[model samples]
Target: METSGAPQTRGARLHHPELSTLVHTSRFHAGRQPGATAVICEDRRLTYADLHHRSNRFAHALTAAGLAEGDRVAYLGKESEHYYEALFACAKTGTVLVPVNWRLTAPEVAHILQDSGTRLLLLEDAFTPTVEGMATEPPETVVRLGSLATWSSRYDDTEPEFEATPDTPVAQLYTSGTTGLPKGVVLAHRTFFAIRDRMAAAGVDWIDWRAGDIALIGIPGFHVGGLWWATQNFNAGTTVVAMRAFAARQAVDLIRDLGITTACVVPAMLRMMLTEPGVGAEDFTTLRKIVYGGSPISEALLEESLTVVDCDFAQIYGLTETGNTAVCLPPAAHVPGSPLMQAAGRPYPGVRVKTIDARGRELPPGEVGEVCLHTPARMVEYWGLPDRTAETLVDGWIHTGDAGHLDEDGYLFLRDRIKDAILVAGENVYPAEIENTLESHPQVAEAVVVGAPDERWGEYVHAFVVPVSGPPPTARDLHAFLVPRLASFKLPARYELVDAVPRNPSGKILRRELRDRFWSGAARNVN
Candidate 1:
């Protein structure tokens, strides 16, 4: 009911007033159209006013629980209005928000909570087993996030004073790396606002928010893509349908049933949707556009999706460090079976993209090098890792470990990853993370994980293991061991028993040497 506000003047306010932090975006929308439907999840539909009030109450709840300004709060659950409530509440109170991956194992979850020094954890009931089993120090304070209605009612709707300034860190996103444990990337609220202002200034109406737009969010909000995409629609005062978890059929049905104008997802998601039963061409009739990224969509899949889905598709190219997307392959560039489709597109306004060599000097177009960018939304620093932060963030530029080149037409084309990371359905699975799990097995002498070409999921995990003396463990044994420790996506699709793992003279595992043969025939190293 009254979801659209009588077509407000386009590009009303790029950033929230005064502080220019994400803290007040919901309040601004609440002031614009309090009655408009803001979020739809399961049996609940929250209006803009509801979102503002609820988030404000949640903020009060945080303070009442003894949370101080800049204190860390972690959310370990699925996508729900409560997550948004906590997210916005953090912005208002200057508390740090950490959306933990619910899919991670107990130890994985504990590591993030401990690393961030999270004072409190807001968890759902389903994940009780995961948290209850954590080996590390459990959070000092815990709140049942899903059952917050009764608790929040005790607090007033008075908005928490906006405390975080433009340069203050708002969110901490943990990202896995090839060399060590997951690193937390600290992002400032101004970064999000700056990125939005840049995108709005570009004048790409197809990608920009407008009246009557209904957004279906399929990605998990824990990831940068999901949070940024959802916030983009929320700021636009559009009706947002946030999926609890991604299911291809659910997405296809929602696109038709909810008359969703646009959806943001990755290539692997599209592949799954196309294969789902009853997912016909007519099911996508209501969709005006589909924004896809993370990893490149296969040419065959892209052609099939274009034929079946009667809507323009756009591609976003960026990373967790870059806030979200800094560049985009617009709908106009979505020609079926074209070379341009292979490129990652040009940089957005306020973002400068270039290729740089080992010397850190900019390379000319067409020269392959590390694909780096200077975005207004760059992460403040890697939490606690000054050396790593220095290595990645140099002179206001993000050194994306991706090796790629720019074409004559300024299109950014990805070639390979300079880091040993496997892209499993848009989620990064570091070899070290998996290898660490594997080496822990008493029977396993060593293990190596690499991305192998996969038709459906873009690239699936493939592990090569060297066993200790006796007959090696079967795939079943390995699967059983991994099922409880790692996420399903990170589990190897297939395993190979090897005599010895490839290693350099210094005893470091030579992963590229092992991957060279499998990827040599492919067009690019990355799937």
Candidate 2:
């Protein structure tokens, strides 16, 4: 959870105070509070001074390896002190840090590596097999994270001379590829500071991180929520206690034992913790506020959570392209039976949101249209995908594929996702990616994927397949085919043999129609 970097005037300051760029963020806090603990991971604790020196040495190590400004460095591991080190080190040296999700299969992992054109790959020892199995050429400077300590110790503890600007790409977070292949969302140093600075200027006390704030980092670092949330905790001079892997019981224990004052988690994690045995209101007495996003929380889960927890609940809505959260549902808005709880909340101080029709004209309130937004924290561009960048970011407004309507009071109510995506436990699962694997089977002719109503997970992957003019393929046969190509979570939870897949005139699969057939009599479009 520790982030930020060395003493280096490597950039010009933006509008934000003191620390405008990522490089300055480190020097400002470390100089002010050197002895303060920055991170807590199991038995390891890193102070601000340690964070500065270790990141300084790591910056030199990366420089010695010939990774200069704008070079891409990728990390394939879970959340760790090492992950944050690489993030800040890259921030200081002006290199782009790409954290790939370790949950991806060899092929999906290979695509990100090849697409990003990574120069240095910082990998965990456990992921060696995945990297080795990839057909693509691996990055030249591959350093196993298990030995990262020994590697960085050889370098100098001083900062380098590479100048990074406020607009310099600090990180490239890959979206889950809801539309097609995932595009790298390029975030600058200024992207991290924008929202906080705006909130301070406007005197919005929605998510102020106090000095004594101890944040529990629960989400995976590969996602924007995890990485950006940790960095913000550091920027505010708060300590971050990160969990390597999320378990319901352990999370409750960490809050009880470690006194986690603030936490950023998805709705799924909260749902599990509410049902975890022995968890009660007393366990979370120290928690002041929790910022949750990625998916809308069910009313049932919210009611159960509030029953056992007496803390401020803030709901956030954003994508990887937006840096983190652009809109937030403040604690006061979470009433038990109100329309506000169903809405995605209002925008931050400097962020502006508007719904637009296909013609790009702004739609009036209550009219369902595409959610478009403009914020200081918007991504620079989709890396190497100029066409996609143009399509998504038009005239500085990002067209979020989500179909939602803004109320008179400006709360965004999400109706449906325009993109063919399945929100499975807060993870985006594109049917195209799954269909590609299912159709690869010899016994399958055509395939269509959709999300079905799920109890534990919000929506689980379900596939409909048309068989080749022979015996119908068994679920086991299709499962075996996808085992190697897809990750365990991406695998279809249910399969239905169909005569033919439903498609429109232009050969586009009508996934919503297919979903409706199975989701009949359901209270809502559950996904």
Candidate 3:
């Protein structure tokens, strides 16, 4: 498959089978590479043969325990090798796996479990306290994950027969709820495989993975970043080193001790790792590639990362609906002063990107507007939300609410999210552009721009900043730095210093929270 340039056809569909049945591919490779390590956890290492056989046992156990095909089973726990076993066990039995984020509060986790109508909840022992006292709709069974003794003794010897067809729903991922309550994004085997194939065809060399190559999966499996990468690694016959939870020191230690070559992380994780003491070029000697996404990274941090980490950096740009990455900035573009480093790079081989205005008219290059993406990897629909599905997926294009522009070279430059845009005196101001300018200041460590309610202008830009490792800059000093970098209308009217900004697990700023502070007493949520 070609990994560069445009796709040959407009309506090209993926050739991979249903995702629930996709486990068979890994199982087949498992027998051929029985001794090859498939997963390495804190204190456990499972070879390909072990993983395949154990997941088979898990499948039989689920069936014996009354889990039928298409039954929803939610896995609520932290990242571990057992998480993969639980995930594959669902696929092997044709059950839909719903991985609930452990970072969420018990109430939030309960809401997801309830919404999915899960028949079983598989949890880790470490998180038992969090779920034990929570009021939730009781599933048919509550099994503790990672119990080898129980799993080995429980199920029948007969091999269970199952196949995951393209139409079979493999997983239901809930939205990150950046704006409001989370909604389930239902994906099938076809969608998952399409994304993997699309990514491989877009310059990602998955086939180059050797049986001995160790891949680090630090991100939680609940997010697309963790789930998709793990699946891809498994398919490529590579071993995965699972981190139970993300810790800067742990990540560094894993790389050094486990000989981790490839890893996927968000910008926030990278920042945290860089802040750790004793972290330097020598720490990441075995590391080959670091794929980063979820939010825009500051240019300063991006540059510093290249100097600090001894590995190639690839930036990806996509949403959950678009199978995680529809655009990729390859390793070569990570060059500090390169123009491609500023843009999000061109669209993936199988994806088509366009800019459009409010009326849906296509905007010319260099025109800032909503980013519209067309790809085979686009999600089929939002589960139970037909109206929202229609509103978002139109004319074969997913209307990404993100506002950006494509340069003449087809490089994408994100301005701001449409919902985050501040309307002041009838002029549109993108907070990202202003925040990016502000973050470039020598005294600014981090900056979040939000729209504050104004009696006269309707809404004005409000800046919240975190100072660098020096004397804090006053509001006036920040304004002076931003004045020349941005337009007069875009300049923030109110400036406040914050120790830290509220960010989601994906590192996206919670603009709604910033807006909520100014409109606390008001009826409506937005300014």
Candidate 4:
């Protein structure tokens, strides 16, 4: 990471020990660096003062609309200053902000809105039709992105009259569950700042944010990866350049034009940007470090990134439930032809990682089993799903549904997912969610979904279907049927007609049996 120059007087003290939550940071930064740019999205720019006052005004508007502490306020839109305004607004009022992926189908969007018990939805103008179609039961209040400024202009810009602590819930991000539905992962303010504090205490500089750093956030704010990265920059009082939606060409231009010093992106994004025309070392001169994760990086891609982008590359590994990243492979380990390239980085300070057997017994190093993480960054619980929360979080340790082992050096080597979830371009695609939708079709008697290796997307969804009787449904027919029911990424890229889905005596469908066919020669179970 690029080191900071002489620290600005009042701005340097914005990181006071008392500024533990968003409420504190927002207020502190506004007073310290009112004119400093906090966020940049296309034509919109929010200075530290603008972010604080606008969020405060919106917080009053939320209260005026009868949203009290702990109420859920949802945002269905792409990355923008508005999303962060709503995020900080929610934080100031003790309300939880739920950021929905804008790419999801109407039904998928409806599920998140209803499941979260959302009181108000702050929507983008583009999704008005999608929300209108959800006539079933939508949120009580809906505010369009276009009118947010005018609506909040009537309220006072002063800080809201509410108390917020480090443990207050701020964000409730939904992650696709293995049971065919998405569950809300409730995160406290501490979750956003825990790893930073840990790193400072441990004197670790693996992922440090410096002043004057222009950080590019290519990932949308909906995902934890995006949210965490953005907040980390915000907490450090750095300028954030957020993309409305990731396009390879735009990303390349943004880095060169905006002079982005650091970036956090998935490996797929980096790959796409490299393929853009005229992309060369000149496009990355200002970039000092690039942190990538969401899925494993291929050796070829890693080598190419090092040679072409020619920047320090750090790899992070974690789930949404872990508040983004618990493990980070620092820039020092990005050497080509090294075995460390295949390993997920070591856990952050104050984070504990171990492999556990099916019986919940911790295994020794080099033994692959279910990976578990105990970190202060872990989520509070799976919102409103006590039983599900119990199943995952045991004794403060999250039983990550991943199969991995730690080397003697403490680097994690992920073998496969213990849960049958597919990582397509960075979004989690659960097979059960697709299977449930597929089985709803008249021609599909039974359906199974599995992740197939893909060169660009890391993994693609593949479906094996058993017809009810007579002629089987063609792949084209199935694709059309699923277009409006599931997100585009969740749709199967390939389909096969099967006579029967293999099952155990207990009637459990053998997903592994079908999945193994496509992964026979792969070095790892996941792409």
Best by TM-score: 3
Please provide, for model 3 over 1-527, each residue's C-alpha lDDT reduced to its tens digit, 9 standing for 90 to 100.
32222222322221222222456655665656678788888988998787777778888888877888878888877777777777778877888889888777767777788778889888887778768656875577888876644964577533468877766777888888887678777766665566566554554542234335688886778887788778777766677888988899999999998888888888878888988998888889988788888788888789988998877888888877876778878787778888777787677677899999999999999999999999776777777788999998998799999999998878898888898888899988998888878888889888999898888998899999999887999998998987887889999998999899997754567878878888888876444
Which tens-of-lDDT digit does each residue in 1-527 have in candidate 2? Answer: 11233332312121225667768867777787799899888889999888888999999999889988899999998778888788889988999999998877788889999999999999998999999999887888899999998999998877677667879999998887633677899999878889988887787767767657889988878888888788888887778898887888989999989889899988769967876777789989999889998765655567667777899998889888888889998999988878687788899999999999889889999987789989899999999989999999988888889888899999988765666667888876766567756765768767778888888898998899989778989999898888997888889998999987665321235677898886898877765
Q: Using Cα atoms with residue i matched to residue i, what is each candidate's TM-score against the true structure? A: 0.79, 0.79, 0.91, 0.80
- Please identify which of the two predictions, 1 or 4, would achieve the higher lDDT against the true structure: 4
Candidate 2 residue spans exceeding 4 A from truth = 1-16, 420-527
Error of 2 at 121 (Å): 0.7
lDDT of each: 0.81, 0.82, 0.78, 0.86
Question: Which parts of model 1 have CA positions greater than 4 angstroms off?
Answer: 1-19, 420-527
Candidate 3's displacement at residue 254, Å, is: 1.3
Worst 10 residues of 2 by lDDT: 7-16
- Span of 10 residues, lowest total lDDT, candidate 1: 10-19
Reference-based TM-score, model 2: 0.79
Model 2 residue 516 lDDT score: 85
